[model samples]
Target chain A: MKSRKTTAWIALCASTLLAGPALAESHGMALSGDLRIISDMSNPAPRAVMEGMVADFGEMHPDLNIELTIVDREAWKTQIRNALGANPPDVVNWYAANRMLPYVNAGLFADVSDLWEEPAFEALASTKGAMTINDAQWGVPYTYYQWGIYYRKDIFDELGLSEPTTWEEEKANCQAILDSGRKCYTIGTKFLWTAGGWFDYINSRTNGYDFHMQLARGEIPWTDDRVRQTFANWRELIDMGAFIDDHQTYSWQEALPFMVNGEAASYLMGNFAVAAMRDGGLTDDQLDFYQFPKIAEVDYAEDAPTDTFHIASGAQNMDAAKEFLRFVVSTENQTKINAGDALGQLPVNANAEIGDDKFLQQGFDMLSNNASGGIMQFFDRDFPAEMASFGMEGLQEFMVFPDNLDDILARLEDARQRIYK
Target chain B: MFPTPIEKRSRAAQLSYQSLLPLALILWLLPLLAVANFSIKPESDFVNGNYWGLPSSFDLFANYGRVFFESNMPRYLLNSLLITIPTVIGAVALSAMAGFALGVYRFKGNLLIFFMFIAGNFVPFQILMVPVRDLTIDMNLYDTKTGLILFHIAFQTGFCTLFMRNFIRALPFPLIEAARVEGVAEWKIFWYVVLPLMKPALAALAVLIFTFIWNDYFWAVVLTQGPDAQPVTAGITEFNSQFRAAYHLMSAGSIVAALPPVAMFFLMQKHFIAGLTLGAVK
Candidate 1:
């Protein structure tokens, strides 16, 4: 069937070649690799952005002809295993941190550390840490967006409140909001990953980014004092009724109804949630975005999941893959991703042209200003798939039954040992 | 027909049946109605908290146009057709033979052979995924539409044979005997005698297999990676970004994807109706 499709394609190519001799001119192009777009990256706007970038690369390199493959993210998780186990694609779309670590360690991902030394990539130095395993950079990150607490600007104005810069102030604000008969923060744990967002913010705020990173890597035991401290803070928020009721029943999208309808004031979410909030009929003036409130006096690292690209270890076209990677992080191609109805991400290249969307600009400011400390990919991204799946479930279990924390931790720790071993 | 037609029932019973028919259909079609609702709507209707209300604007052309021109829905539809048609043909053809052997033959292990096909139906598909994928990869058929079609044919043959065997068994055995007594060859008896009478069953089984393979999402994803073999069921998800889901576009793609099977049913309406009403009339 594939051969039939190929034959049909060749037939069409032949027809086009006959109809227009100019089409045959680019047949000299030698650079080709399969650049995959997995998950939500399979979107039309994003895919168009990527296809445009690929076309742009063809114009720039003359010999570049990368075949862009967009696989549904759900299938990619399993398809990737088979695609890699046999003959890996020239370049594949994958996430940063522990997600990439296993593939890199197993020599599935080609080391592109030399690309790190390029002067054009100087601004992307912070993103490299997430893509690195054992001090060796394996991939080049292209897209990452901010994950922050999206609060009600109108509520802040009405209650004469200010954005909390510290954990105490955040708690105080939550208490004040609740005292006034409103919910403080909203989260939907139905999908479980939203629970990971709360765990991430709390862990990052309480124990600092290092501990959060360690916990994700299974380097820190789940039963550790610091891990307990993170949950303790989460428990306090639970006790304060900071999160809305029956959050376990609602997805993150479902949880937006509370905030959008004005029953809830704040929600710690990524920029993507902004699209949802607007969809729920909230105007831009009503909502304000802020970085998650500070906890202990730790360096300000945040959850910023970076979508990255890597050359396959078994790639038939290493030079083309490297060339494609270089083109991707270039200011031109990177800016194309941020252009036109595509604020779902912030381009990793600082030199890339930023779009004019205020929400996106705010995401840019929050990430850039807090860049003194590196970005950690969100929990699901920062951990291996199986471990991340278990972690999200553990977080969800905690949200549903906060008192069963110890049991959940022990179970996660057990899975951690089995998985990370 | 066995329960008796609604017209044969009492007035009050007929009234209940007539009243309940549309209600049951609507209930069954509620999810489909929602998809239809979403497909015609602009994205603003979803955001503005008016899901069940009349769409603010009818953007059917825009929505479906994007699905066809802007997105890969057409390619996916073509892929679905390529994969589904071949599988249905292969499964129905093979199962006709298998069902014949098991149903007509008085050989040893006839029940055992029929039971094997039935048992295959009971195994949960999830368990077969890994090994099936590994086997596909080993055979160098991984990521090809042929691989997906082959696996679908192989897996669906179990159900197909069960359906075919039961269907063939219900036919008159005297027809085959009469053909044999007329000095017709056994092969001719099976082909000209039995195959001609099996039209309704074939038509019924074809529609079932076509719909099953057409709507199949799991094997489409497992056996094929990209647009080369990925069918419309898995393809609609391309509108789903890791972040924001394009429900409107996905719905449009879904409607487009659902068109062929619907068209097939309509085109084969005569055969389908004839097959279903096999013993209805005295």
Candidate 2:
């Protein structure tokens, strides 16, 4: 019955959208003046997507002068504050969740709760909590990608093992892989955030999503018994020699060779790793995906780091800025921009069709149907900046020296008190 | 002699020296050779962890073609030229006048003024980064070629002035005295006599400053950004995308960015060597 209602509603939306000129007039036909946008989609493929969106949006509202500036993606992090504190552009790119907290509090991001009230935004319900702060929405997510374990199918087949579904099965599979003279997982903690991925999965699976987010919010101490349980769970695999040796020396890209060369059977990485694995000559027949298995019977809580667009609080062209954002989240625009040959990621709008790639399809299915607990914005984006830095460092040390757990937890507990204070 | 040449050593020692010299030379040049090798490799080779292995396929034309035709490298190279040429001229000209005044006039506090020029070189430029950036922003010159050129000229002038002054002091004094005795104006004595005599100093300083400004990555990053104003040194990082570093493309871009200063060195080899020692002894 719910599926039928969704189909009928989607049909209604399609009819109105297809009705053409009269509907378009109400949508955004009157937008004019210069609508400036600063995007951090500076990579070649995403750069084209941003420019294409600007061109199409300009064509739709011919009277509106749309200006687009693309900044280098990494440099934009430091420069965003300067851009927002002064004569800000109409729209700018940023991340979702706690990453937006500083700008929201500084009054740099405009409140867009009214936009969320519209029936059209229902398609983006999954990410609404991430976009909201203090009971109001600050931005809209455009794209996000899922995180999971990408394993070598041939290795699993040779060992007569299947994708693990629980903590017990996972360890048993790891032992089998070790017996076969391969590490169960390959990870690089050199830059320190890759270890945070392991923590996010283990912590979320060990104690449900609510407890994990509470920990992220610094409501719970790192010395909490529940938190130790998460570590104890992780320590099992570390103690079993389940991960590659000297992983602290490699970058995330450098860690890819282990899985590609069959020294490691799998990698617990984001969907982006599939491209690198493929570049390393791992064909689809050899590579496959599986969700991180159940622990403590908690529902699946997936990491899908979202990239968003927010209207500047000091926008000169408010109406046009809001309209352009609306245009950005429109089903057609999201579908085109996040297509396989474009940004090559999942669209935020549930109604938008996913790309035809096998990994993208599996990721979409897993996130849409299986991720009932929650969608986390990864470790770094979910936590405060200072805390995430300290947390990742501690996590890397813990991965390297499991015996240092006591000292690490105490230091983190101290950081939590200070940071959240 | 306390120490002898390689030929004066025993046979065993000479043999080791002959063999180890080529080994050391190869070791020293290995990194440069690796960069050249990487610049011609396919992008997939990096992903495949073939970093030190023979490239799976030669992609010299494709990679370099992308750097030249598809990327913003040409514009960045042009920006470097625009910034470097003006800075070299400005620094050399200002220092020539300042060097002439301090070297010839014997005015009050002339030695004090020369000491001040030498003192400016003692400052570590890294300490000036924040203040210099703020100054440019306040002057409304942030991210402009003029701002970079101005800063480069101001900062480089100190060393240039020191070099020019010492070189000018090394010149025979009677030539200037004779020019003065002919009732020629002081300015004419500078223009016709001292200036022509300072040609080698000017060439050495110009080549030195040109390379210095062209290769400056730290200030280039601090003072400017984007293709409109940034020099090739900082702009080479444009090859890194959000997730992955394009090592192949960056290697190609680095080679391209390095060519101008290298070409200047080769073309002005005499001036470069002379510039290194011109003011050191005298």
Candidate 3:
């Protein structure tokens, strides 16, 4: 099967090479020397996708020796700095938004703002804002997944509740679900980042995208009235006993059973949870999704964290690296890589067709059209790492003990002051 | 004194002891038993929170099949063997010679030289993590099987030397003297006379070091990165994907990774036990 795919790809490549002289010239110029790529897509499926892309690109330009090293995804988080600081690769995998702040400030990541100016990159405008820092683009997004409420449709149907839209309706639905002797939501704060999702959604929905980005950039203090308002709104649900009890003890996957067993009606999670939910035996009719309900009169600012690729500033093959970045974000490659059997996420290219999954369609539509406010890269990616760590601990504390709002806010305020400086 | 045997206790006490012994055993082995159970469970069982329950369906072949056929596990296991066998042979060979010299000879600073070998064992191996990694990179040995093998031998030789030296010291001094009287050269004495007497100690130390090197996770992770060099201990984590931990696959992979050391322990049970008690009794 793999040989057949390679043969077909080779035939197509030959045809394209023969048919387009302009394309051949462009490829020839960028195909010499070597392009060293270090990817963190080390899972079996994504690893295959990365290798397949490299192989195809290598085939297109036989002279370009493509060296690909796939580091384990979690380990890459720490090893990236060392890998970049020393003998750096031409291209590397990273995330979009403030997560790139350190590398950008250190001048380790090369600015790819010129690529964004090209007409081909206009297809990837949805995530352009996320890739921008200091009014220049640093990388290009390859894939992203939306964060929202994945609820037990059967439980909601049995209880005769519709998906809530406004904050009042969301509270009403939670109250109804609570009355039915089931928790309204299942969340695990043991690892603490899960609580960051709650904060991003509530905080973004309360004060719009700009204010939330300001808070993420440490421009607004954690003790601000708007930040407190976001918590006060969240406190209503906590006081109503809406979340599963003893949630602090469970990891995110551990919290899945509450919804799977019908003890909880909903989970605020990313699109990846659908696979696990289906594995736990929820059919399409039994499961559903909805954007987090509006709290105040702000535009919907969804959390769609994008995974991206950036060229090293110390790259030896800058032209090849730039061309490879273009290859990664191209409509054809984006669609193929993010297909249902591949990444199973939304492709960033606007012209690219998404996978035929129910949630993917919703997420693609939501991010491309409905999210007029802006895209958030989730809290952990949006905030500086130190502040995010301390901020998540504070968020988890607030969820458990809402009365310690002042103390948590003060601590986060201190962390923000120290971290941002 | 040790507690009285259950057989010697009163009838009621004996009955209670018999009943509680199995319970205590199960309680102690619960984590292992759970891992065993998890290895055969379908992935959905974990998702459904059926952690302690019987598997909904038997997936033993499916899970282990993926680990063996579809993953880098076989290569990792092969790396483990390549790493372990060489380290065991290298460390044992070097230490055996050092032991013979320290045990049989009266060289200058002999006690001090032995103390240096013993002191190497005292420094916590964790503290060596950074410097050892830097050393490997400096030697251009990082992420190679040779690097891991060399480090394992270097680190493990310290403990193995102490064991071999003491075991050699306990051998009769008359043996070497007898070999000398027979006009045997010194190297010949080590090979023909002393090495023959150290057979049990060699077997015991080889078994001990084999398990140590096979189960070494910390240095394996710090020194190596991918399947080309990483042993099964570090490579077992490859079962975890970016977003989800494949608990079933990981459990199966772990069982496979653990098999070599477990098999060694069982097959070399006598030597293993002797390795534990050899120096202590002396």
Q: Name the top DockQ candidate.
A: 3
Return the TM-score for each candidate structure.
0.85, 0.93, 0.94
Candidate 1 lDDT tens digits, A1-421? 8656544543344333323225434332433344432232555676666667667666644645456677655656656756666667787887888788778777788888877866666768668778778988898888888888898899988898898889899888888899889999888888888888888888887877778888887898889988898899889988877888998897776677688777899988888888778867788899888888888888888888888887778877666676667767866667777764653578887777788778788878777767556688888888777888998998988877899999999998999899888
Backbone clashes in model 1, listed as residue pairs: A39-A73, A40-B241, A40-B242, A279-B47
Identify the candidate with maximal TM-score. 3
Whichever of 1 and 2 has more DockQ, that candidate is 2
Between the candidate structures 2 and 3, which one is better when assessed by TM-score?
3
| Model 2 share of native interface contacts | 0.34
lDDT of 2 by residue, B75-171 (tens): 9999999999999999999999999998888788998999999999999999999899999999999889999999999999999999989888989
Sort by DockQ, best first. 3, 2, 1
Off by over 4 Å in 2: A1-28, B1-13, B273-282
lDDT by residue (B1-282, candidate 1, tens digit) is: 598887898999999999999999999999999999999998766644456878888999999889989877788889988999999999999999998888788899999989999999999999998999889988999888889988999999999999889888888888877877899987787799788888888998899889989999888877786576789998888887666667788898888888888988998889888987896853
**Tell me, what's the RMSD of every candidate?**
7.4, 4.8, 4.8
Better of 1 and 3 by DockQ: 3
Q: How many Å off is the CA of A149 in candidate 3?
A: 0.4
C-alpha DockQ of every model = 0.28, 0.50, 0.69
Q: What is the lDDT of residue B9 in candidate 1?
A: 89
Residue A261 of model 2, lDDT score: 87
Give candidate 1 regions above 4 Å deviation. A1-41, A63-71, A79-90, A341-344, B1-26, B48-62, B97-125, B165-170, B173-191, B266-270, B276-282
lDDT of 3 by residue, A68-99 (tens): 99887877999899999999999999999999
